[model samples]
Target: MYWIKLSKIYFHGFVAAMGVIAVQGCVLSTDLPDYKATLPKMADSWSSQLEYEVERSSIVSVSQTWFTPDFHQRISGFIVEGIKNNPELKSARARLEQQIAQYEVSESAFFPKIDLSGDGSRTKSSSKGPDGERIKSYENSFKAEARISWEIDVWGRLESESQASYSSLLQRQRDVEFAQLSVATRIVLQWIELIALEKQLDIARQEKSNLTEIVERTQDRYQQGVGSILDLRLVETDLANADSTLTSKVNEHSQAVRKLELILGRYPSGKIQSAKEFPKIVTDFSAGIPSDLLVNRPDLLIAEQKVIAAHHNLNAAKANRLPRLSLTQSTSYQNRKLSDLFDPYSLVTSIAGNIIQPLYDGGQRRAVVAQNKAIEDETIAEYVNTALKAFDEVENYLGNEIHLKKQEEELSRAALMAEQGQNLSRQKYYSGLIPILDLLQAQQRFFVSKSRLINIQKQRLLSRVNLYLALGGHNTPLQKIMQTDPEFSEDNRNL
Candidate 1:
């Protein structure tokens, strides 16, 4: 009786505490450590490590109108189409919804669970009395019961588990965002490549036409006895080579068109035509500080979420070794007649609290703690490696931007000179003042120079694309708001 009375008092106190918590709507009063505090130190600025002067006036993020605003706008339609149809992006969104559902499931643990049950039984029996007379008896019974069970979170274990689930949800959210960015980047690259292939095909067709005309002239000269048989053979060989080159270029152009159509989530019918011209390039942009990577990059944010989840998992594992307190209440009604089941005399009620302390579990709890710690370590390492690789990518693309520009300029001059030399050699060969070999060499040089020029120009554009991707596209409006609003910042997210 004394123990029952003591339990009642303790239960009342617990109920009062729970009432206050229910009003507050929080599982724990204290906050966990912020993820930023756990990050490794990084350089203050990106330019310090770069060889060239980077315009540091603004952080270079993915912008709608990037290095080539005109080109970006032109491709915006394609990007929109791809994002809508991309299977990977769709899958990421579905995973995000799945994570949201899972988080809700974890949160349900914080509330009481109630169950109801009903049962009815009927029996008939007959027996013989000691006096040899037959006796018969009939019996009927019914029961209805309701039970409520709640686990008290005295050690914040439930809170930690919920937090872990929430972190995973956030990770999934970031994945969706990352998928969108990736789809955009890929579409841009494939579009640029298609244009380059188209240009190359044009060059190949022109070369084939020029070689065909030369072959006709050589045949006429040879028939008129003004050119050697050897010269006619050379022209024929050149024409054949040009035909082969044109065929290869046509195949490449077709394949490029098909690849692009696929990226846009369309049928690869090899019929889509890319714009013959490239958009104007604008190269003056800034690479923001390295710290922005933590804020702007989705993969890094996902990594941070992983770390947060691992931390909570370790906490929950440790809590498993501690005592767990749970309360169960059951109310039941029983009677021979169904109508009298709920009668005051037939009613019974009971409430009990149980505290289970782990006696032994073959070191399972300790092993779980150790395992979570290892996972935490792995996430940290991966985060660091990802950051380093991001840094490297940014640096490499920036350097390529400079190098490719120089290459295009030099190749442009080389192509121009080669064109002049080839023209002069052809004229001299027609006048019989230059050997066939000299004319052939000049033509070869001209073709190679023009091809290189086209290729280098494409590379320059692609380098800029890569640079924008590496910089981690521009911050969204919500991110901008978060930057200015203290309440939305990562540090205050717990509140």
Candidate 2:
């Protein structure tokens, strides 16, 4: 009964000791700044707040869809291939894996480390005893030990480090997402450019054909003594200019195809096939608000993650200023006879605990704390700047979308009028009612107007692409953003 009572008392003592150690563990506290409240407010709705109407007959809503049917199979295939094979994206994925490994490394600090070691030796010695006798001895010794050591995270330093690594991993994940978005955007825009160039080539060939007909007519009139040599020369000059423009367009088209091929991670053979016409894209974009960008844009997400990591790192640095506690336990066996090495009588066991508090380190610990705090502040500033930049991009693209559409409309009307004027002048010239110069001027105006119209159409498509990118590329709807992850939603709420 007395032994049972003694055992109970010992158990209570062990429990009390553990309680004291747990209470002594560092309780980390942080003055995490509230940067979310400082984020500036943006317009409530892009359409209502903008200077012009974003909705037009041609403008289609892109809130639900990213790529329209007009993109075609080939362009979509190229974008997918680019995302899968792009070296930059592969590198980003590797970096994310590295961060994951680092996170696991930090997590290991929470557990104890055990080691087993053994040694054996043989020795021969000579000894003198009682100043008259000599003795010889041979000895063999064997030792084996198992030890375990652990640092009790009294101040939450290890926990903070693990959190920092997790945040870094998330940041890298956002980086990969951003890289993917960027790659896809480039592919889409380049595909559009290639199509526009093809159209320009067709337009140039038509203009050349028209100039060739005029040149033949001028030659015939000159031969019949009805047109002056000066008129024939002017016509020939116009034909030459048309031919030159056609050649330039062909070269440009070749260069564009090669550039797109390179982007697709293929050889620049200048043989890429593309759509003959520019695909119509959705022009209208609904930029929800600035706060929405906090969840939508990958770059902004990365910045926010950085701020979180910095906060954790600063906390860790502060925690480093406290005392550390370590516990060690070891069991061993040693015997002079090899056969007796495992005997119960040869066994030994010991346990020890240590507490180390920094006395002086040439102010190194304080310096680290200061540096981490400064880094935290820098990250906060960057986060704010990134948020502001995202808002500015949305605004710029919103305004450009409106203006480019208006410009496209005006240019289309001008092109129609120029075509009519050219047809009327040709008829009058054939009836000898107008001079060759008048006919040439009308043709030139029609050609220029058509070319300008095509150029503006290309710009409008590009603006739509820019608008898509500015609004965080493809999936910017609140529902989609929220579905990314619970942590993402939490982070957005924090923002």
Candidate 3:
């Protein structure tokens, strides 16, 4: 015991000396890497561009705009309303709450375990007396006691469990946040698509009106024998198609609008106002050194924490194989009558320490340790995979966004040329220089190009949303929630 105490004192002194040195070094501000300053020039440049665009971008206050205008229902804001109103998001949040509850329950293990118990009973007995006679007696007995039992976490197993649970709670919270981002991105993408469809329908309507005028002019020329019978027939066919195309496009637009509304927790209304322009985003981003990413990404951090928790769990399993020390004791005064139960003369006290070692358990304990070891291994593998996946997602989104922007520009030019062709063909046919078939061909080309353009724009917007999610967009939604939540009020104190 003396030698152990001496060794412990020596270890403590060494640790204290090291701690003092560490504190002194920390005070000196040992030239740690200037992380924010050294942030990738690409990220800084892109962030500046993004901020510029966001500042210039048309702002619509979703707060005032009814999500379902016909229904007179409006969502509060994109951040809080988005999470609370989304069912999938709510489910994820509930899981977060469960983990938090588990953390609280596990935390209780850190405190002493005590019980207060009471019981009442009646019994009848038969016994042989000195005269060989059996007798029965009735009595009511009552007992009450306060019991206290404690297992001192001398080796810190309990503390490790509590820590593991805490990490799990944090991980769950991050998961809920991630889920919120995913839902928001989906809603935004669908909204963009619906708006694109609206624009597409408008384009279709304009083309239809233009074709109707061309058709009427061609028919008049045919009546005067300036246009051929074939030309007139071809114009009639295109006129019919224009009507059909308009209806089809309108239907398509309604479908997309409905889906977006569903995501916003509403029924689709044809009258929902879509923004005239799409949100602009900057895609240029570069992740810094490999070492810099671990703390920056939440999902990666969560996976790493899980691995750490698993390792601690395995250690706890091993600790279970060793005998645990518990001290249990109780003091009580009891009698058949309540009046006598409080007597000091009737008091009883006992104290004892317990030790139980596994003699044999059909190898159950061994199997448990092995299983825990395997789980730890799996967690480590998951940690590695999750890290790699996060890195890959960021890189992929960045590259794709850059390429998609160029594609959008090219498609826009093609759509413009098609529109020009439709105009030229119409004038040529009216002058009797070309058949009506030529005009219809020009119209088809215009329709195809315009459709392609709309799709590309939608794709571009969605790509940005994907990139935002991959790069772990700022948790602005959470901040917005904090500002307005009633629970944050000073009057809502824990008391």
Candidate 4:
């Protein structure tokens, strides 16, 4: 009983001494490094020419819904299905969940660890008394103990670990958002291409029908000795080429449909139907300042998160080289009878504290700190590289829109003139006023001009889609989705 009292006094003194040591460690430990110092300078305005002045808005404002009710209805349906079922997006979400679980595991380090254990043993011994008489004795013992251990984060090592995990989780969230945006953009492009192929097929079919009529008329004239064999053969050749062009267009359309189906996580059956007509693109959306990309673009945000994670990891590595304080407490009971193992009178309690300064470890801790610093630098460089690439994409797409509009206008005029020439040549050939070669050339020009016009129109639509993507357009309410979680709400507020 006197020993128990004495132990209590010693435990209190030990706690007091450890508190002083912990305070000293805190004073000697430095605060985390400024992570923002690693970032590159951001441009105030985009290098690309904008039709309107740059508008600085909230991140939510930047997520303009690109698809509207008046926009192609079938395309909207396909986008919905694709977003719900895309395998890549599903995997991204799963990774986000994994990061969440990992963050929770890292956060658990802040709490103490507890364990319970028990044991029972029986022993028998035979011995000889001083008179050489044989003596037999048996003893039974049972014991149970509960123990707890906790590490005091004097140098903020645990805080840094938790921060790293949180940053990683944020990175995964941005990845999922970017994946969703990519999938939707891909589906829209495929659907647009498929519609373009259908338009081209219509032109091919019309060309074939006109050539078929010309061939029939030439054959009749030849039978009556009015048309030469050369003329008849030339017409047949044009007819055959028209048939080949029509067949190729059909195949291209089929492939485009199958590609779209694959994006929707469906079998590539080529059975998915596209919109009857190409979706019209609204070209008037504003492209915000380049600085907005840091907040609006998910991929950019993801890169920034990587830098944050690396900074925290470096801090944790540095703190690992400092002194660590740990405390332990244990309670135990022992009795010869198992039923009395928990008796109050038989219980013992003890408390202990220790500090580990890591005096020497063959330079292992220093190497770890160096490695983390290098990693931090690598992430910073990668972030700058990613930002530069994003700027290039936006500029290129914006410049392309201007040139594409000019091309579309000129192609439309060219197609109209070629159509008129083909009609006049057909009438002249049938009236014996023009040679077969002249008519064939006119038809070829008409077909080529029409095909070019259709393709340019498709390109313009695709350009709009690309421009929207480059500007960080979102098809869903990303802010609402993020705000559903309390931690993400804080992030949004900070953004």
The whole-model lDDT of each prediction reads: 0.78, 0.80, 0.65, 0.80
Error of 1 at 33 (Å): 6.7
Write model 4 residue lDDT over 134-192, tens digit each, in one string.
99999999999999999998788899889989999999988877886788789878877
> Total clashes, candidate 3?
0
Error of 3 at 131 (Å): 10
Backbone N/Cα/C clashes per model = 3, 3, 0, 0
Best TM-score among the predictions, by candidate number:
1
Q: RMSD, model 2, all Cα superposed?
A: 6.6
Candidate 4 regions exceeding 4 Å error are 1-44, 50-69, 128-137, 474-495
Sorting all predicted structures by TM-score, with the top scorer first, yields 1, 4, 2, 3
Clashing pairs in 3: none
Q: TM-scores across all candidates?
A: 0.86, 0.84, 0.76, 0.85
Compared with the true structure, what per-residue lDDT tens digits does model 2 show for residues 1-495?
Answer: 999999999999978865765564434555567877667665566543357654556443456644455564556667666666677777877887788888899999999999999999999998998887988899899999999999998788888898899999899888877876787778878988988888888888988898888888888888999888999899899889888999999899899999887777787899888788777654454556666777878888999889889989988987787778899999999999879999999999999998776769999988998998899889989999988888888777777767777888999999999999999998898777899999999999998899899899888877667777777774642224333445534533432
What 10-residue stretch in candidate 2 is worst by lDDT? 476-485
